[model samples]
Target: MNKYILNKQQKLTTEKIRNLADSIGIDALGFADASEFTGYTIRNSRRRDPKLSLPEAETIIVAGFYIGGLTLPAWSNFLYGRTSRLYLSGFFLDVVKPLESIAAFLREKGYHAVVCDSSDSERSVLPLKRAAVRAGLGWQGKNSLLLSKKYGSFMALGGIITDAVLEHNTEEEPDRCGSCSRCQEACPLHALEQPHVLKRDTCLSNFLQIEYFPENAQSVSENRVGDCEICQDVCPWNRKHLENPLKTHMTALFQQKIHYWEDIFYLPNLIKMTEEEYESIFKDLNTGIPYSIFHRNVFLAMERAKKS
Candidate 1:
């Protein structure tokens, strides 16, 4: 094919992919030059190199799905940690699955495609938040989260890397968090050091999600079992959208009522279960968070309750 014809075909294919993503409920979709993120570092020594995940990657297609901001209210319910799990589960179904489908579609078209989820821990996978920003989907908020003007910071991100040289969207979202420090002040553990900078070690959410709680975090690791949303909750962007009523249409699988931390920790079967058994019960909550970590958090919450 002539160079001009090839370029036109590629643009058409890219548009088709974007249209398909929108049809599948992806709130935002954009293509970024994979090479632009070749040396993007997320933090200390964590560089985002697309080539690591997909050697043939030429373009990165980033997508975002709105995870309704209203879910925060339910997260405030200390007795049941259902909101975060529900949001994550929905993210897999809504964001990850669609990205996988997009990759499959690209592969069917004879392009080398690889899907990357936000939960992926592999070093090769570029940070989806940065990729999204590069694609003009949103900007990184003060809380270190991708904040979209349309969806705020409540959106979940997923992406696909393909060798196809699609029409790219390089428009970057300018930082809109000018002089706002709500997230920094809201962190109970003082995790936010400054705008766009975070102390992961001191973050309660990080401690609760890991298998073993750090000795230094034992004091504040109580009452929360999994993800923490305090920083996002206090963000002006999130608060603006949360003013609307919550959309309770989403399903929560493990919604069994529990009045207190003891209700979860003292259950006869729960107390006697082996690590493997305990893991099986909460395995679906967040694949990134191991059952042992959650179990440990429960114990901490129980101890805190007892002391109080």
Candidate 2:
């Protein structure tokens, strides 16, 4: 194929990939070539004790799906109170199915796309997510979330890295969060000191996701033990454009006033939460992600309730 014709096909292939992701339930999609971060990766690698960035990756495709919203039944009136691990709050399992499907599709099309794993894979997830932002899926929010001008931070990220020599797309998204302090103000533990950066010591999500909390963060478990949504919950951009099932599921967190401990703590019951009942709780439009994390969170919540 001639260079010009190949470039045209590459663009079409990019669009095809993006469309496939959407058709499979990805709420947001983006394309980025790994070459964009090579220099930074090298420089950072030299300075760190160990590095996670992959030097040879050529393209990183990022897709995000929604988790769900918070309704009157989901939150605790107490600043540090019990909040359940219902469907809306946990959908990590659902997003993975579509992600794997997309990756398989790309591989069948003759690309070696890799999904980075912070736990299982040698490559870093940050670079993958960073590559996603570079492809214009969203801007890096102060809270370290890739917040799309089109969708707030209420999305889960899935990534694919490939060596396909494709022509890069130049379209970039404008950071529409102009002077917005909602995310900064919403953090219960003060994680976001500035826009697009996070202080892990104070990040609630970090606190729950990590098994061992720092000595100073003994309060972390007593307080925000599960997932933290305060920052993303308050974004104006997230308040809009929630018509998409995934986006609506995520944006629903802020549309309520409620006082209740999480209703379900036992994991075994999830197998029975009816489709409507499950969707009403977690906001997951599809059953791709599982409720494992939420169940884990429930165990913690139940522990907290016991202590109280």
Q: Which candidate number has the best lDDT?
A: 1
For model 2 the TM-score comes to 0.65
TM-score of each: 0.79, 0.65
CA-lDDT, candidates in order: 0.66, 0.55
C-alpha positional error of residue 62 in candidate 2 after TM-score superposition, expressed in Å:
1.2
C-alpha RMSD (angstroms) for model 2: 7.3
Question: Which stretches of model 2 miss by more than 4 angstroms?
Answer: 1-5, 8-12, 36-56, 70-72, 77-96, 117-128, 211-224, 241-262, 266-308
Count steric clashes of candidate 1: 0
lDDT accuracy of residue 300 in candidate 2:
52
Q: Clashing residue pairs in candidate 1, if any?
A: none
Candidate 1 off by > 4 Å? 1-6, 42-47, 69-74, 82-87, 90-95, 211-216, 245-281, 306-308
In model 2, where is the ten-residue run with the lowest total lDDT?
45-54
lDDT tens digits by residue: candidate 2, 32-138: 55644553433444211112344555666767765444433324422233332222344433335567776787678877766653222234454534666677777
